[model samples]
Target: MKVLIVDDNQKALVIAKARLGKEELDVLCASSGKDCLEMVRKTTPDLILLDLDMPDMSGFEVCKILKSDNDLSMIPIIFLTATDDTTNRINGLDLGAVDYVTKPFDPFELRARVRAALRTKQLQDQLAELNRNLEDRVEQRTVEINQLLNQKDAFINQLSHDLRTPLTPLVALLPMVLKKIEDTEIKKILDLAIKNVGYMKNLTEKTLQLAQLNSSRLQLKMEKVDLKDEIIDTLDSLSSIFSEHGVKIVNNINSPIQVEIDKVLIKELVHNLISNSVKYMKDEGGITIDGFQNSKDVRISITDTGIGMTHDQLNHIFEEFYKADNARHDRSSSGLGLSICKRIIEKHGGSIYAESQGVNEGTTVHFTIPL
Candidate 1:
């Protein structure tokens, strides 16, 4: 470490220098306050021993000037003064001096004070270096995560495109060919082929949608909308499907219940929940939709008069590709519907859960979004 000692008394400067040099420090001397400022700027010593009394400028004035400069402020200053007044000590400390030393001081005490200040400075420098390294590591990890998400999206897009290219023509041409066929066995075989082809196309579209939702790149288009109206519109779009399954939907949500949300995603969420409930319901069963608002959020629920789940089944229902034993053989289910619904609720900054009393009872799906 380097130490700079400033004093108008040449004898005192020489005595202080010899005492500190015994500690194996590189020592420099300045005869006046002006010389001290110039030497500090040039050498940037780690510690400064300043004499308060001087003919040209007081040590307090030199200390103030150094503290004002951002580059020189942190060099620890210790006022070496002959005057032992309490006010003088307070003023020196207030001007950013680290410690105060009396003239004709003990050489042992002076060396000890110098060591303590330098040790503190060393620890501070190490901490600052560690913080910089931590910031760099966080930035690098963010870049790697972004790269992986982009690669996943690219792979999903290509796969969907390949699957759809063949299924599209098969879906359009198979029905036309069936209309011209006369043999009953061949006709039944063609019908089964058409159904399988349609299922594959549906699976491809849903898989791509789920992958996009899972990515960080998806951005929601937020708007203020009526919750009841949105549900009614979704029900209207799927009215024919519900009728074929002998199910009834009773929407009990009131009008003027406004919320800020992404309209398209919410519609998809309601559609999936209702369709899943219908698939598990008894013949001519009913689905009741209801919602209400509290201080912080709006809670909406869809209750189905369908076969309820066991505790073990409820735990894994929202997970991707998870299906109950009964639904495992159902060809219409892709096992991704409820998973997509869960993602949609998460994207809206909300919570979703399912409640079932017991087997053969009923099930209710509840979700909450910010008001």
Candidate 2:
């Protein structure tokens, strides 16, 4: 560090020069406040010790002038005076002097304060540097995330448009050819082939929806919607699936609850959860859709007595293409249903999570939307 000491007495200057002879410091001497200010602009010392009583200008005056300049304001200043008047010392400090030292100075105490001031300045500089670095890192990561999202959008578009187009013709032709077939063995094979194609179609649609959500392409048509009606309509759409699996719905939501939401998206969100419950279910099970409102949000839960997930499975159920161990090899899954549902809920400024009492017990999915 470089320290600049100013004094009107030549003897006092000599004494300071001898005391501040420690290593790693370059000391500069000024005979008056004017000379100190001038040397400061050129030398830009890290710390300054100024005599409070000078010929023309007091140290308080010098402190004010230094602090007024933005470039010099951060430099630490300490006052040196012969009088031990508490008011005068406080006056110097009020003008922004970092510390005060009485004249006929104690060398050890001056050195200690100097070291403390320098250490404090070091920490401040380090913190400022860290803030600058953090800002730069955040900006860089934002650019990278944007680039990745753009590439994901392009990939999903190609998957939906280019790929699904070819599969559509094959799917349509396979069904028509099956209509003309008479052999049971051949018909079964064609039906199996059609099922695989249907899975592919479902996968493509889910990918498109997820990609659109990630790209922020979906705009919500926000309106006050009848929550009960939406749930009933969504369940009605999937009634055939539930009937096929022998899954009865126990809708505990008795009253109508009004909510601000996008009707289409919220319906889809409900449909996905209910369908998942019925999809993995065996014969003779029940699915429940219950809702209630709190002060800040309206909460809903879907509980099902189906093939519940293990802790490991529950952890990854919301992730893309993450099927539980039981359903990992099930070719019917696009592995994107829950992921799409999660994205939809998040878009509405809501949250969703799942809980399970291990495998074969039950699973409950809960979600909340702001009121």
Top lDDT model: 1
lDDT (Cα, tens digit) per residue for candidate 2, span 54-173? 979878888899999999998989889789999988888888988988988899988888888888778877897999999999999999988987887778777778988898798789
Give candidate 1 regions above 4 Å deviation.
6-12, 30-41, 50-104
Evaluated against the true structure, the overall lDDT of model 1 is 0.91
Q: lDDT scores for all predictions?
A: 0.91, 0.88
**How much does candidate 1 score in TM-score?**
0.86
All candidates' TM-scores? 0.86, 0.76
lDDT of 1 by residue, 1-371 (tens): 89999999999999999899888899999999999999999999989999999988999999999999999998999999897889999999999999988989899999898889778777866887898999999899989988988888888888878988888799999999999999999999999999888777777877888888888889999999998889999999989988998888888886667899999999999999998888899888889999989889998999999999999999999999898999886668888898899999999999999999989788999999888
- In model 1, which range of ten residues has the least summed lDDT? 120-129
